[model samples]
Target chain A: MDNENRIIITVLGKDKVGIIAGVTAVLAEANANILDISQTVLQEFLTMILVVDLSECKIEFDELCERLNEAGKKIGVQINAQHESVFKYMHRI
Target chain B: MPITIHPDEILETIRMVELENLDIRTITMGISLRDCADSDGKKIADKVYDKITTKARRLVSVGEEIQRELGLPIINKRISVTPVSLIGGLKSEEDFYQVAKSLDKAAKEVGVDFLGGFSALVHKGITPEEENLMAVIPGALADTERVCSSVNVASTKAGINMDAVLTMGKAIKEAARLTQDQDSIACAKLVVFCNVPEDNPFMAGAFHGVGEPDTVINIGVSGPGVVLNAVKKHPDVDFGTLAEIVKKTAFKITRMGELVGRVASRKLNVPFGIVDLSLAPTPAAGDSVAEILEAFGLERCGTHGTTAALALLNDAVKKGGSMASSYVGGLSGAFIPVSEDAGMIRAVEEGALTIEKLEAMTCVCSVGLDMIAVPGDTPEETIAAIIADEMAIGMINNKTTAVRIIPAWGKKAGDHVYFGGLLGSAPVMDLNKYGSKKFVSRGGRIPAPIQALTN
Candidate 1:
């Protein structure tokens, strides 16, 4: 996978129904493909990490982030989308 | 399957950024102004302005873009130029002031927070042009915003230049007096140095050296809060284990600096210079070097064993940071500025820290006696003596040291001078009443120490 086009999206907040649905809806609208997802609920809090492919996204990276953030806010969660390289560079070395 | 990164690692990174205040302190673009020199001071000023504006035009935007994309905070985007004194042919003090104005204008136009290198390297002796540049430093810094100045008055090889030291003392006093209404803020933008590093990305000490490339990008990483949290996590660990933990945390923080420097270098098409592995602290709560020291079981920073604790932390940070980056330059250790760290301020306020103790800590710390405020009535000769002491430390130990002391006009010990923001506020600490007039008045070079002969 092209590292530059891969983004790790983290959604964290209180556990609620449709949290994933709301977040994926924004990504779907932007044509972003969810490559992998691992989610868990511990102590009534939801922690979701998604590896998304933005190579085919139809919007700018910033716009995608904003849309995801807005969707997360509406769904009562906080979303952060960061380049995968930041993670790789910090952890792998 | 997508590249599998443990969820724990992802969460840890998030925690460092969100909860621990781990962030890149600065992305400084160093632009050499050797080519900007001209026989005419005005022409030189124009050339310097045009070059800086053109070179660093995209610095702030690129920094912002990277910040958003990485979801990390890059606190400052700054520029460092070659020392203005090196750009010869500027005769009068007014000519140097015009050049300083141009540098300030360029910094504003390019949107950088501060531009350094209105400096002179008089480690051994002062030149005619360099002297003129030093003379104008007070007025230049007071008249302009975002123009930082530094004067290197001593080095291990050339020993201490008492003449330059005394000159800088007067200049600092004048800078304070000129901006007294603003809490003597102009003095905060000036630094006096011994064994100064040319590629330091932090200000008010950063400057492009003659040996550097035409332009380059250097990164200064800051994560004292992150280190403090790591220390807090393992309260029962032994000293060896504690050092290991701090080193590991420093490695991770410096890795972020390396990545940011590489990304910004590629985006800006400038050569990657270095990643300064300094655990720079801010005035923000929980983000302090003193807090880290206190976490090491010290009752407070500047108490007994404080210097030893700082030595361990500073060494561990360097060890971890050097392994994480290809190039580690600048003052790559912990910065313990009084006003800039909340815990340091608290320590001073509670009488746990003193200027004398800070001077001792500087022997092991990265820089020396930074951002300390003294009484307004403190004599210039005393200031020169303090700087001389710091220079002597740097000379004998072969490390970089600096003095950024502010003698706040009309403010006495226990009074506060508030510059706000990153400059922070400092309580004026009492100084030794004894005068150094007799010692500093007999001014001459202190001569190279035995350590200087490395052959």
Candidate 2:
């Protein structure tokens, strides 16, 4: 996969219902494909990681990020969508 | 949906940026001004301004765009030019001052945080025009906001130029007096160097060297907080293990610098020069190199074993950084600037750190006697002597060292001088009362060391 067109979406906050639904809704609206998704709650804090393919996204990368941020705000979470290359470069050899 | 990267890796990257102060310190565009020279001084200033503006027009915008796309914090976008003294035809002091104004105006027009290279390379001896340029540095710095100036007074190939060293000392004091109302802020923008790096991406010392390409992009990576956290995670590790932990963390940090440098270079269509693996600290808490030292079981940063700790940290960073990048230049080590690091400031305030200790620390790390403040009434001879001592260290060791000391006019030891922002506040440290007047006033060059005959 082209890492340039992929985005890593991280959601961090208190665990709650519809945390996934609220975030996925924004991605679905933007036509961004979820390649992988993981969620865990440790010590009452929610940590969700999503690998989204942005090649088919209807909106620009910045616009999708803003929309996801707003959706996270509505659901009382903090969302950050960063290009996947940052993670790959930092973690991989 | 193929899962390639582990979730832990993604989470770690996020934590580094969000929690730790991991950032690309600066994206510096080095532009050569050789072609901007002219026989007339006014024409030279105009040409310099036009060349810089046209070359770096989209630097800030492209930097912001990359910052937005990667979700990475790019702290500063800056430009470095060929040393102004090399861009000839500026014969008089006013001519040099005019060139300084042009550099500042061009920096502002292009929206860079600072523009370096209002500089001269007088390591061996000074030309008349270079002397004139040095004469106007204090006034030029006081008059301009974004322009930075540096003078190289010594190198291994050319021993300490005591004449230039003395001149710079007087210039520092005069600059202090000129901007006393502002806590001698002008001195903060000036640096006195011994073996200054031409491709240095860090500010107050960066300048486009003559050997470089017409234009290039250099990156300075900073993540003292991330390294601190990594070291803290293994509080009980042995020295070797601790060094390995720091090495791994520095690898990750330098990789980010490499990635950012590549991206910025591609977007700006400039040649990628090098990634400076410096653990540069800021005034912000938890973002200090000194705190990283204290994290190594030292009660205070300036206590015994501080230099050893700093040496381990610096070597580990270079080991990790060199493996990550093909080209690593500049002063790629830990920086211990007093005013700019909160932990260092506290160490000085608590009497744990002194200028002498700081000088010792510089032998193991990068840069010498950085961002230190002394009494305003301190004589120029003393300042020159301090510079002479640092220059000797650099010349002997064959490494880059610089003095950015501030003689805060009207401020004595225990008093603080505030420049705000990254030029943070510092307690005016006490200096040795003995005068070096007789020694410094004997003006001549200290002949090059035997090491220079390596060829």
* DockQ-based class of model 1: medium
- Tens digits of lDDT, candidate 2, B318-359: 999999887999889999999999999999999999999999
* TM-score for candidate 1, residues paired by index: 0.99
Off by over 4 Å in 2: B452-455
Tens digits of per-residue lDDT for model 1, B378-423:
9999999999999999998999999999999999999999999899
Residue pairs with colliding backbones in model 1 are none
- Tens digit of lDDT per residue, candidate 2, span A1-93? 246898888899999899999999999988999999988899999999998998898999889988988999999999998888887788887
Model 1 CA deviation exceeding 4 Å by range = B452-455
